[model samples]
Target: MSMHRTVTMLAGLLAALLVGAPAVAADNGLTVLAAPPASSGRMRLQVEVTDPALQKELRSSGASPDRFRVAVDQAGAQVKAVDRMADSSRERSYTVLAFDQSKSFATSWPQAFDLAEAYADELGARSGNHTVAVMTFGKSKSTHCEETTAAGLRACLARVEGRGTDQPVTRLKFYIQEAVREAARKQPLPRGGSREVIVFTDAGEESPALKVKDLARDARERGVRIHVVVFSAKSAGKGIAQRLDEMSQLAEGSGGRYIQVGDVDARQAVTGLVGALENLYWLDVAFCGVKPGQTSDRLSVEALVGQTPTAWSAPIDFRQRAEGTATAACPGTVVMGPSQAQSGTSAQPGTSGSANPPGATPGTGSPTQPGTVTGSPGTGTQPGGALGTPGGTQQPGGGPGAPGVSGGPAGTPGADAAPSGLPWWLIALLIALGLLLLIALLVLLARRRPEQAAAPAEKPVPPVAAQPAAPPPAAEPPPAQPEPPPAAPAAWKDPFATLPETRLVVSKGPPGLEPFYRVHKSTFTIGARQGEMDLAVNLPQLSGHHATVQLFKGGNVFVKDEHSTNGTFVDGRRLNPGERVQVRPGQIIRLSQHLELTLVQPGLQPAEPSSQVPIAAAPPSVPATTPPSAEAPRPKARTLYAPARGDDE
Candidate 1:
């Protein structure tokens, strides 16, 4: 009997060892999770190791922080930074559960609703810090429960019911979009926290109103992970398969997962979701070779735990750093010394003088001081005064210099002495008087000559017989008429008048019946309002006064955005509100997504020349034939035709 007891004890010990081995292995498994919606430039991650044993071991081992390594790969570029959060608490997570209440989901409504409630309750129980929100979409979207506690979420789910039995068209894309929008409406998760959305739907039909690709893009842009659960009773077929593929893409694009269920237990789906969420470990990494708001297509992460290296890769979207926030990892400030050479004089060998010289302006002395004075001369001294002299004397009759005056050699006058000659004004007056007397004498002599000549001419000579009057000089030939100035070239007509009139054609509208508008005015308005716009478009997307089209005098057409809610686009580039951009023929103008027009100038077809009537030679000598009627018709009056406006004058 004692031997039997020993054998039983050995069996019990063996069973205990087998059970503990799996637990130990699980404790060693490393799972890394990153916050979804990658940022553009540098990203901060919070890293966690789910295994409690490993955490305790790491703490006790006193391993260097370097033991935890994080590397990021983006668009073929790789970077590595130390993981700083290996010892920190687990990050908080915010989740939003979106339900589809469209008609297609009516059959599976009860199960889907129950699954959502159970998932919410589980998440709340797992972590009181975790936040949960519930949203439902059908013909419209409504938030049944905003972020709240576990109890509140359960109560909200209980009251939720299918909208109605009416089979309204399913807008799957719209519902997905609303879900992401609603998720983003909540307060953004704290730095290093995770935000995600779980969508429950039947995947029966998709709405044409929204594109699946667009929905995915929006979710990704908002950084909200979308987890999709397609609960349906329909058998797997082409339609169902397509729906599943699209839903999977939507989830993966936003860094989430997709699950499909039919008739089986729905709890499995919820369990899988919860497991994924709970197992996530935050990874904090530093990025290099990318600027804030700059994105890279390829991003991967790897970690080193002890000696083993484990890696996880996904398309990384780096977050834009806060505008004024300083990077925590940057090196500390360094004290810098003065850079001026003069300031360093004390440090140099054999330099004993102060930076500034004695009796000199402060901070104004040069390193190499001149022995002789370099400033301007004193006020009493001339600029050319000799060095070392207080004031120099001026030589007699020489240009003035400094204060003292010296006499010129022997009889020469000093510079300060006055001249001993007659005044200059008196001498000038005498010269003027002498000239006036000479002028009077010449005038008297001229008057005497005229009197002598008159006495001599008193005797007259005998007159000769009158000569025949000269024939009147022949009249000069008529003055030649000035040649008429060459006629000025007819003023060139307005160039735009000849340019083919441009027209806007509705390229996306009905075939063979597209709307056309001739560009008659220089400026015209375009918008949705009938009375306000010259070209009115009755579409919801277009603003009341969306934009303006202007035909410039030079024949160029331009469009200006008018601060519309949905901005205008030329070709494919969006125009800044209130911006004007030149447009060319064949370019597309999009006032909104649904309304687009093409600018066109039809080619001018050359006109065929009309055959000219041959002029008949006058009939040769044909006798005039009288008509039998009483009187011949009066000769028709010659008719004149004025040229048309555009025709040659």
Candidate 2:
């Protein structure tokens, strides 16, 4: 077949594979909004017929037609309308014909964005209660979106900076973080007010210098939502979609959302962004005792409906199960540890539990002597301490070493102290039994039955004595099966090989002249040469609604400071109260020493471009809230296929 034909066939196969799912056209036309960024104003739509045969067939017959609808909702009122028609026979596909053109019943796919744009217009018109920050670097020259609603919003674009042409993700993240925070804090947005931080940026970030964790925390605390709309693609011929994917990761990681306007018409991009924000599920969880050196593994929670597990959330570790009572596995459980492979077990709903780590040593739950573990009470220095070995010291069986075991120091003596190592009791009992058996054997020999002697002596003497017994050919025991060459030590393999890379996008620390800049994934390890080391970390905020910064010198958290506003306080004192605040890791530091920020990282998995999981902040009964339909029509949405509910619990 001709090359073009071959290509067409492959495309057809791929499209068929993707499009076979059940059709779910809403009986009620979907409302859509098209709010493209300010600079990429106007919009266009295109529809292409890739297959020559399909095009020829259409030419011989007639043009293929398509339809689109839009809707708008404010408060309890909702309005719906049909915006346009799409014709696919005239050109290769549909191509952008005009900007801001309105149609009735048909025209092209571009109209989808236009209707969505109209929806955005209506929402934007309502006196915006929250400030939307627009930050730009290397080009913007300090302009805020709130200042000029139409132009500022449209100007949401990522500025190219530095010498290298490649879009460094670090710079993009820095710009977005600065813009969002400045915008949210610029105006005294009242509590519970709607706010957004929209960034028009390239998807690249350089070696990170900013603190992302503190910034993310602050945004969540201030009730300021974040959104990123990218205008450029990676310089390496990468698709603009890839850039959008990265932006979405950062935004969603920080409890916000993002979109790419390059591929989709500007209208669609804007509409989708606004609509997604409206329907997002933002939840918070408060946790304590998650200090440094403490186990953050095997912890998970779920919100269930009777027996069937519904929404579940777990820590990064794989050993934890939800505190739910459901017999069925939950779909929302998240593991906090390094592994995603986990075994599921039934547990009470709404409660959490951890599977004890294999061979974990039981600790005394008390401070060890200074020379012992690193974090012991009296240890004066840094570097190394009395903490367990790298392989993790085994504790007592029922004490600190047991699985899911917590509370207490290592080395505390107890009946279950696993420090005894390999269970000597079994060996001792075996030896005692062996000695008893030996004595019984001797007794049996001394009491042989007399009948055996009388019956056997005559026959053996008559036959064996005469022949000198040609030595009976020695019988050989079966050749010892050569121990199967120990199966080549299972080739070392990384469980996280398929996982996407985690990028650190934001960070924060105490303002200083000689500041430390180290961005590792979503965390910033902050410290100076002399002063105590500090860190700005981005922790997943789930139903718990709280995250903390813990400082560990050796093996224990000497100081724990909370950055959560609205009561994340320290030592009985509420710092920011309900707002995001910077709490010290230890009691000694003040706001100047203690630093905090909301950090942004890559999606938990590559498939999930948006790390923000859908967690309901309100009860399920609270009406199905869709984004303003007019702003963006619901195109066929592609959601990451999560594991079957309860498969991982």
Candidate 3:
């Protein structure tokens, strides 16, 4: 009995060991280093294996292409494709390090920069052909390095400072768009390569200027992955937490990862980012039954090595090229009856086959036979009149008669008639003589009127007794003049007391000083008209009334497009005509291709209300009634245009 029990226990232990060995071996230290965005029909991924032993094992096993299985599930439809890339010989990697320089990020500046440097170094070591760039954003965007080698990137990082403004606001969305645009300008990667943007920020403040959805779309279209690293000390604070959530949504939406490194060291943070890149593997996916330009089904991709599978699923859109259609040719010329001659033929009198005699003239032939009349070209009479030939002369005294004959008139066979009336000049002279006699009679009556007035002015004037003037009464002291009412205080003590102010900085024109405008009024106009617009932009691309900035009574501000020709852009999006979008303090308002302005709230806090002084009591006195004075006319309101930097007026 004891020997049987021992054999059973040994068999169970052997089974357990066998099951555990595969799980341990499956952890071959392979990680995704970079992943291309999954938008088009195919996706390319970059994967690396860190363990030297596992690399050797993979080589010795001679893992065939079939070992890597790829499948996609799109809109409930599953598709399978081949794994085309097995090595990274011709791969190129791009990395953009974006730093957030808001006030909240100042505390973590040192650690964040160190981590970025380390990340760059690791990327360079893994792939010698990799390129790197750096961008910094606070109230605006600044490009430090663009498409440079790893060493050049380091040099650019060394010059970076934590000298950002105290305001916690940052234009995160604009910076993201700018980074993607910069990345797209670089040379495209090889068939199996990848692009990545690693953003290091505390993400404490949100930008109201742009939408998160738009940023994600731009990144996907550019085929770039955006990985966000939250490295600020206060990243867990309530405000910062919300910002982090937004950042995470952006990362996930673009098929990238969001890592919270608030408590981790620089190496750990960098390692997490690198690991995500190493785990990516490329697959050449074929969408079965999908035509070019047709709306494709939602697709999902799953890559399997042995029995382990990594799956990526999303809906994709494919652009269709326009197809040309055939058009019918227009008829060359109009077709007449069968008897008609061909086009461009001259008419022949005798060739028409008429029944007229051989020696007959064209128009003088008798019309007794039907074919004789057809021989002459213009012998047929038009419907309304008896005129037969197109240009035949009329008879001397004919009235509604045939074209070639004379008609009887005044009861005779062929007599001419004369008109019976006096000439127009004799009648006109008689009317003029009557008008002259009437004028002379009126003038004679007017001259006798003055003589009649002189005869009626003989009435007499009666004499009046005059009273003696009394002595001047004692003069009374002039009444004291009321003091002019003190001038009323201005409605707003400071123009920028409550609302945010935006400074228009010229990016394209000749370099000079920029101008700043305070948004004090409820409604402000922006246009090219000098006196009509409050914030006048002189660039030719701007329309007469480009846009309007409105500050609501509730302390919120908005921007409305005024149907400008070039267009008004909030962030990078063009606003539809008459569209009104809320304006955040740090948002960018682009009036034209050449004119771009950023809204900035200068100080950290709004201005405080001014204090009021108490008035002392006054002695009471009897009131005297005074006549009311006329009210002064109100002055017309005028727009205050923002002048250029050097304009004296």
Candidate 4:
């Protein structure tokens, strides 16, 4: 055969073989809101998918659980099952799209508009039946659609004829604040609904009247995230760079994304954002290969989507299941289906579409720490005090040490670097709703596990047809055991990873701060320094060793000033050196100028009137319902264990 004929034959043969081969596994933007796994049995994960097509399939009735597969990196453990958290699975969304008409965008105006329309048109499809409002801003602003469906957005796009203003003094902060307000008008994000404002801008400006901080605060309060799509040229200018910084601030502060896309990838970026908004899941995963008391290795998961597979992984922060001395193998129940490789680079957090974090999913008993972990392992300079490695190494078995940071296990080259650093603001959900979610969860439990909730039925003994058993000779009294050695006066046995009953619910703090921190130590130190303090605060105003919260034997709480630069305050009074004071439930602990933590006690609400009364004016009898944190009654390691509950718990 001629050379050309032979090449054609080879190409045809290659195609025929390839058709039968399995699809390659790739990252599909799987975002896991990681929590320390249940110290033992199984891991419960709040998993969200940001793949447009896959999201639809995941929520559809057609999804087959068998098609999904999950695996862990450890030697023996694997994922047993994945369940859809009905309460956490989001269903609706709203978007406010504002395209910039600034002078800086003069060169890329046409391209910018094209990208905006493309983005709006696609997102308007309402994958999960979301609404979008399209508008334009430069010297002034124009609303094309305050609220519209996919069909409506397309209809209004024809009327959009926009370009940069001659004198563009963009009040970017005010612009975002307005957008967030519009979102708020829809009311607090309804269950299964997320709010977002996407600003397509090549440039920005902040007027003195409005500020990023204020906008961020507003957006967080209104349950709105602000995402900015920057269309940059290969040779961008300094002016553009400045605006990019401003855009980043707006995005970061508001728990949204700062997406950078060239013309070639606009579609992909927009698609990712769309999928991110409405597709979230809850996974009741049973981890395998867990050694008792020892922290297990990181975990990974995989799922097949049509011919291709997608992978995900998270660091092993799950508290060990077996307590103190024993080790247990990960319960690898239904053998994992397919092992998925860990790949980075592909997961971008810009549009995680989670709660404006530092929050929780309302109406559902979701992840106890629903806030996303997005802070870097560094000083206490900001929110998202994600579990980071402190100075000391964790001694084996539950010994004290600040070891291991949070995130999925480290990946090879090209893995994502921002896995654990989600903006804290995004995680702040409604705190008041937490009570309702808990009550509902308990009621549901009462219905589902009546046996566990109710008394076990007594079984009747068979009629004594058989002769009555003779009374056995009285057993000799057991030998008196030697008196157990007294526990060290200063030592206490702290449950390594289980959450303690004494938790500090952050009533007021930075954007992405953990809401409720389980305090397992009698003398739990709270401060800004990462490795040194038991509870690390991200706010910088506070000193390194700010204060200590001591929960004593009788549930009495006291706080002591650590001689911090910015003194700690209980209720409203500042603490003096060595002046330990008693504190009770419902009192607020203010650290420095920025953060405030509230003491939460179950079945324990302080006398509200007494708490409200002036400290000096009140009758001395009922002392502060609560003190700051730590002072006298200095106990050692904590003993009361309130393990962070997984969905199962």
Best by lDDT: 4
Which residue runs does candidate 3 get wrong by more than 4 Å? 1-65, 68-86, 147-150, 162-168, 187-192, 235-239, 272-279, 291-296, 305-649
lDDT of each: 0.49, 0.30, 0.49, 0.51
Ranking by lDDT: 4, 3, 1, 2
Q: Comparing 1 and 2 by lDDT, which wins?
A: 1
TM-score of 2: 0.29
Better of 2 and 4 by lDDT: 4
Instruction: Give the runs in model 4 whose Cα sits over 4 Å from its true position.
Output: 1-47, 50-90, 124-128, 162-167, 206-221, 234-239, 252-255, 282-649
- Residue 109 in model 1: shift from native, Å? 0.8
TM-score computed on alpha carbons, candidate 4: 0.33
Model 1 lDDT per residue over 1-649, tens place: 4444444455544444433322211222333334344443344443334455554555566434434433322211112343333234554556777777766667777878778877876767654556777777767666766655878777777777544324465666777776677656663534544567888886656455666666665665555677887764432333453455567677766667666564235577675565554444444334332334433333333333432332223333433342222121110010011211111111110011121122222212122331111111111111222121112233211222322222221111122122112245644654554555456556556655754434445678799999999889979889889987554433323323543466777776323333656554566677656545666555544566778888754567999998765578999899977888889999999875667789976544211211331111222232234223336332331211111122211
What would you estimate as the lDDT of candidate 1? 0.49
- lDDT comparing candidate 2 with the true structure: 0.30
Structural similarity to truth (TM-score) of each candidate = 0.39, 0.29, 0.39, 0.33
Candidate 1 accuracy as TM-score: 0.39
Candidate 4, 420-526: lDDT as tens digits: 22222321322323444455556555656746457688999888577888999989999999986544333323332233355577787767765566555567877
